[model samples]
Target: MVATAESVAAAPGWFTEAIAELPEHREVESAGGAIHLRCWGRTGTPGVVLVHGGSAHSGWWDHIAPLLATTHRVVALDLSGHGDSVVRSEYPIEGWADEVMAAAAAGGIAGRPYIVGHSMGGRVAAVVGARHRESVAGLIIIDSPFQEPSGESIVRQLRRTPKAHPTRNDICARFRTVPEQSVLLPYVARHVAEESVRDTGEGWVWKFDPDMLRKRLEQGRIPPLGSLRGVAAPVLYIRCERGLVTPERAREIAALFERPATVVELSAAGHHPMMDQPLPLVATLRTALAQWESR
Candidate 1:
């Protein structure tokens, strides 16, 4: 079920409170037929857009977006097929990139903007930067596996695993079991769980289309490494030491960039470094931004 404003407002006490804390914004329309985005940040400030990984929405950045908004006009979006965005039964990774570009354009981010993405979003960001180099100021990838996604890979196979939920109550119960399944902020986890379901006659049910996983698996592949060579802006890759994206593999991928790319290994973090260690992640981002501005 599509998320209604009333439903969002009537969500659990903690989630409702969390939603209240977010800043107000004008909704920017996109041609992709998705919900117009609610944006934050000051006008004319250097733009920075955050893209989330698969099965997640813009809420994933609930913890980090506010922090980044202080410096740059940060914009985190719910890519099509996730969150409040329109549900497309068949969506491809490239289509996700196109939606981001369209959203950025509608938000008046005309020139190169700092683009940061996680997991699948990281891959989309790379494709955007490579294909639209003139519009990308810098690229920041967080814990995204740069290796090819194959049918045999653990993640790919897991996507194919059929999850059984007989009722809405069952779905909610399953969610409760993994309340802290992610390393993102607690509020983010709450938002994800809250937005993930719809109150049906029987109980709560998943809002996202299950086919999304299969589409992702079928279309998700390692983008051509050579494509990154077209990106003129410097790149910074923040990788979690024990995350899905290994340090050695990150270095190897970074080497493929035509320009030298900086890689920072977060020793005590996992896939969601921003949530696992916010301060360090923020500091690293600040340093990278400063370095890029200096150059």
Candidate 2:
């Protein structure tokens, strides 16, 4: 049930408004490849960059980004090997961090921007915060795990090269999160599913490279959380109630930071809050930024 333009136009008022606030599509060159991004709000406004999880793309934030754009310039990016971004021989988390900064500059964010990342993207954001503390305003990590599981192990466990589907409908029907969740909103899922695919001359297939992890694995090892110990930016760690990060784990991760970190939760939300609890997620993000601005 891929959502077409007609269906999105007919969606509820909130969704209709968000979807109507179209973003300016832009690309910035990175070490890996050209990073594709969608920017909303006027240039020179306070900026915030939203990053999707592994195997997910910026389209996942199509609905959420515009809502946040009311007070901030928002940019959601397709990391290399995902969505329309070029695939690279290696997929290092640090390289993804550089892409985030590059996208911010290319998207016309006037100053250092808050970097918000979900799942594996959160780890990438952590790297940005650690490496460029003076260059970033803050960091918001949503439900990212802090561990050193090998990329090969991750690829073996979660990734499978999907076969081409004969029709768009066929492909959308097969759309699922990597760590499949139980509480995805059907309308949101349908909309994202529609954007997740591309039509080749032969048929339709997912845009993300299935071998993205395998390529990273070839890099020998994924960077561990010890690198995050140097993070100096204020950190807001959002833990979804039904997501991967548990309360105990959240505290442990927070303690690793050089400064204090704030830990909060989204009630009843899954790992993919953009799919299951977008409004709450947006509200939480806005509230966090407001508090930081006042501080």
Candidate 3:
């Protein structure tokens, strides 16, 4: 759904209330660059780290993170090269994972925390679970493709510089997801779209580095099955019925994990569940966390 001024003004009470519980901003250094963090809830609570997809930043979880914060210390980070984080010469899955860990620790997560990631971030979360198994309690991957391209094909889509807009409103109006989905909440869309841009003295432009993907593609650093195989924590694989993971692929991904994994389909959601199905997504996550409490 396109975010119009009318829709934003009429935003549902829940969304307004959730976003009103503003997060505390923080910064932590990782892999030679500063990583930005947005933290919610009380300090010293169990942590939940949220990871956004490629081209997306921490604000993508603004609404969702606050809701998760009721019980857990929830933090969302701007991975290096995205959002407010400084750009890096390289963007590696391992590096992104490091940022996640650093942010979780600095954000006051009391113990081993749950890591939840969407799309490309899901792969990063898997890497964290695999490499730092003892530091993570569980993994939740939402709609990450079962496989990513390899070799030169990774850069088949040539990178382009984003055109700066004369005004922030213009930039926000032009905001669109990389792989556009059919369903989106206008209020949520407006919130993320506005958060996605920054005003350069030149003009308003997207905050994410345009060269980030080029660096990853050049290095052939796409997440590999080895990482998934290395994850030791129990997994919650959330597949949106209308999103990227197909039934067969979902099963394939679950099998890749040596640890126990459960697959739950979110009805009527797209790749971005937080955009189209925030409440249901929250309910699902709460239920899953409760079930894993005794584990």
Highest lDDT against the true fold, candidate: 3
Between 1 and 3, whose TM-score is larger? 3
Candidate number with greatest TM-score: 3
Q: Which window of ten consecutive residues has the lowest lDDT sum in model 2? A: 1-10
lDDT of 1 by residue, 25-144 (tens): 434444446643545566567777889887676766665666666666777777777766777766766677777777676555536688888887888888878777787899988888
In Å, residue 234's CA in model 2 sits off its true spot by: 0.4
lDDT of each: 0.67, 0.86, 0.87
- Model 2's C-alpha root-mean-square deviation from the true structure amounts to 2.4
lDDT of 3 by residue, 186-285 (tens): 9999999989989989899898887776777644555454646677788999999989889889988888787657999999998889989999999998
**lDDT at 228, model 2:** 67
Residue 75 lDDT in candidate 1: 74
lDDT of 2 by residue, 105-179 (tens): 889887889999999999889888987778899999999977767666775655555688899988898888867
Q: For model 2, which pairs clash?
A: none
Candidate numbers, best TM-score first, in rank order: 3, 2, 1
Clashes of each: 1, 0, 0
Error (Å) of candidate 3 at residue 24 is 0.2
Model 1, backbone clash pairs (residues 3+ apart or across chains), number:
1
Estimate candidate 3's RMSD in Å: 1.7
Every model's TM-score: 0.78, 0.93, 0.95
